[model samples]
Target chain A: MSYDFMSVQQRYIEQIEAALEGAIGSEEETLYGVVQEAMRYSTLGGGKRLRGMLCLELCRLGCGEYERAVPFAAAIEMIHAYSLIHDDLPCMDNDELRRGKPSCHVRFGEANALLAGDALLTRAFEYALRECDYAAMGYERGVRGALTLAQCAGLDGMIGGQAIDLRFENTRQMTPEVLGTLHALKTGALIRAACLMGGIAGGMDEGQLELCEKYAAQIGLAFQIMDDILDVTATSEELGKPVGSDRSSGKTTYVVLYGVEESRKMAQECVQEAKKCLHDLHIEEPFLYDVAEMVISRTH
Target chain B: MSYDFMSVQQRYIEQIEAALEGAIGSEEETLYGVVQEAMRYSTLGGGKRLRGMLCLELCRLGCGEYERAVPFAAAIEMIHAYSLIHDDLPCMDNDELRRGKPSCHVRFGEANALLAGDALLTRAFEYALRECDYAAMGYERGVRGALTLAQCAGLDGMIGGQAIDLRFENTRQMTPEVLGTLHALKTGALIRAACLMGGIAGGMDEGQLELCEKYAAQIGLAFQIMDDILDVTATSEELGKPVGSDRSSGKTTYVVLYGVEESRKMAQECVQEAKKCLHDLHIEEPFLYDVAEMVISRTH
Candidate 1:
């Protein structure tokens, strides 16, 4: 069945944008407002909102109201945004541009950017826990969802992945296993979290949640491989940031390990695997397939 | 009424240290274990475990076992350690020494330090939530305590205070009120969280929690005033950090607004008020008073 993937994506994007705008407080005249301003600038600047979309969609597919997932959707996006801000810091990637604009540090100064990243991360938890606890969402599910969020964003997850990335930079020890570990933690972890938390929010059972994790793992890996390909193929303008940075920095991406053609085939295989996982569960949402397809075809 | 304050303090410190040591995992041989190393380096290398002591003492005083508060006590100290790591970053305070040893960024690189701080903060929530949900702690109290942890460490709290401090640095517009607000958010918020969360862990009702908050607020203020005074009166060796940093940076502080003599008197008054708060609550915890006294008299 042909699905209106573009329209659905657009709708989800709009919902996510509105939720994100509302999630962050308005800029105040107070001295501490600068961090808030920096937070808004980065979080609301621009992106695919892919993480938020996955969360909302997964929640809807799990027979839960998508609206119930909006807070978490906004949260994952905020987390993604904060990671980007920190990733672009002078001490990290040192990139001055992100999403076609000056990075947080470039615009707000380094200290404010650092604090903004810190604030955005802390605020994400607050927004998440707002819908949790003794609220409509049961305590067990809320705690589980929160644990997923914290773990994915914590030492054994995204931060750990960054550490690996930094350790192996410009080194010849970047093996397939190391690269896989890096991608899984740095990027895949959050993606899986978005999926798992969405399922948890929808009150899915352990089996269903396991299926969600499997599907997310496949797509997340595919997404990173495609990202590696796009870094080599897409223009700087198209990507909204500097392209070929991985190659310039001698970062061992999928495209570096396997050539462009081989990487494309690998990503396609992962997407196929992802779709099969969804199909095994008889998910009514054909849009999940479309999202997997987009991961392979996405240019930026 | 006399308490063996020294022995009790020593015992509590030992408990906190052991808890903190156990809370953080050992360094792994994997690529990402370096972040864990940095996390341990900063958290284990500590000064006074005052926050943890308050949490445990309050829990015990509220008719709950102090052991129940150990997880939270360790969590607060982790949060505190992370803040110190970030504060001593080159872009922030630029301090090379923390607790008379090299700061995280100095020992680890700036990027690693940043990631280590992020990891610690995220890990704090993970550890706190470990005892929540369907656990012995009722979901209501668990959620309340977690919310307290998030809020106090968040934008309107410690991070917000840091923003204000950065904004007003070397500026002449820092009034007594602004300084008060900064101190309340920066240092007082976490101290207050320690007290309130400790009370929450003990299942204290709203009224009892209010008393804990009042006592904490007074002590937190007194603590900062003493800190300001110590910055001038104590030697760097005694403080474990550079003295006269405020004056050198031209940063406005309690001592900046009110001279050393006045600040000392103000701190003493706050301690008196704090004691009254406990007395009115009919608390039997004489160690609480001792802890309050240490805040004003501490050299570091």
Candidate 2:
């Protein structure tokens, strides 16, 4: 009864990569050429494509048209890519490498990288809502999807988490409560949005959408806790960037406060909670349970 | 039969300023406090609110509910403020001042300023589409308005122009065609969006929306040309920043290429063309004509 996770994941990644490449136009010699190149370089370079997979898979679980969700899937990936680009800026985390390649700012120069991030974020919305005609996916779903992405990526969500992180860096102000809030807003929001958007696309009612969000929220925290553990235990080559960045930067993380063993236990508990939500929602898909397990199992 | 230009303008400014202030929440003591302060500091500092006025006025001309368009007006101004903040970043224009006050980075460190800009842009869309329920502004209008703002502010528009400007700065590669494309995308696209968004809110058909876009494009170019002329002729006290910045940065502008006298004449011609579009659309609003005239007539 086990699902073939590897092949399904590979197919999803291919679909996502193709959609992402197609989303950014192929005009490199034009006026906005360099920024476009930077965008393509950073977005198409490489990543786990976790958000896109979650979105597309959830949509399939909801029985929504897989083709209709492709743009949304690509859009979320673009948002995630832009965030990483900005997060690696000199003024931010200042990471020089991402996914074993020079970061966007390092490769494209600072100004172009900044504009590329801006362009990616803006174009994500443009691509997602481009087919907002009355006939295409219906206006309601389009608006809902757009709003979910915007709100999760916005002030009270990712950027807000970033501000908190920057302000509290090198300080002892990050308590467990603060850490929970920070991680929830920073990482959980987008993951929750991906789930909710997929649910919306699949015509899930409000209760079902809420269940998806709850499940996503649990996995999101688990994902971050696992990331912290990986940062501490994984080799620099495996992580593609320097390991222990959080410690070096004096930033607080789950593994910093609660050693690796405790963090891993916490991630397992979160995954278990996430699986419970899926069960409560009557979703018996083995992939759903497998993905929750994968959150804690991912090494990089 | 003439409208009271000063009085009408003052009222519009009041409405816009109030809407903008109301749009940004008052939560300065939270984790996101510093970034929110930076957003308010830069967004509420001071600007002419020209884009807001254009959008609101066009909406009125089309007989849409003034209250509904207020969010869109404030949203556009937020986008403008964010752009100015990023433009003034050290990696970008490196300007120290904006609106007679220290820039966002000077007031709030570099990272917070960057986050503030990102938050503002994301929240602009969130705020505009918050009421996308079927009973609200109608999903079609909401989608159209959101799409218009996103497309105009995105890769092929404002960000694209900024890339070209940055790439060609201090270089002799900025041909006339390049300059035209730059201004049209950087400046014209948003203005055109304002007009078209207003038309959409007012329930104008596609053809009428096209006329509003045409009108806006003409005035957008003229506005930029006039800005170039003022940079040469006006004082720092008048423009709220260094007057000869363009020339000193080795950035080519309309005045640099054609002289102030010729640029003024060109601006006037553009205004005339804009008026012709308005007339063709049968929009007898004198305020629209006066606003177009103000583009060329203002000293700063």
Give interface RMSD (Å), model 1.
Answer: 0.7
Q: Model 1, residue B11: displacement in angstroms?
A: 2.8
Cα-based TM-score, every candidate: 0.97, 0.97
User: What TM-score does model 1 achieve against the real structure?
Assistant: 0.97
Residues A1-300 of candidate 2 have per-residue lDDT tens digits of 456988888888999899898889775678779899999999994888888888888888776456667788888999999999999999998999999999999999999999999999988888888843336457778788888999899988888888888889999669999999999988988898788877777667888898999999999999999989999899999999999888887888998899999999999999999999988889876877888889888778
Pairs with backbone N, CA or C atoms under 3 Å apart (clashes), candidate 2: none
Per-residue lDDT tens digits for candidate 1, residues B245-299, read 8899998878878798998999999999999989987976678988889888887
Per-residue lDDT of candidate 1, residues A83-193 (tens digit) = 999999999999999989999999999999999998888888877877553355677778778778988989888999999999998885799999999999999999999
Model 2 quality (TM-score):
0.97
DockQ of 1: 0.85
Interface RMSD of 2: 0.8
Candidate 1 chain A: 10-residue stretch with minimal lDDT: A130-139
Candidate 2 off by > 4 Å: A132-137, B132-137
Where model 1 places Cα greater than 4 Å from the true spot, the runs are A1-3, A133-135
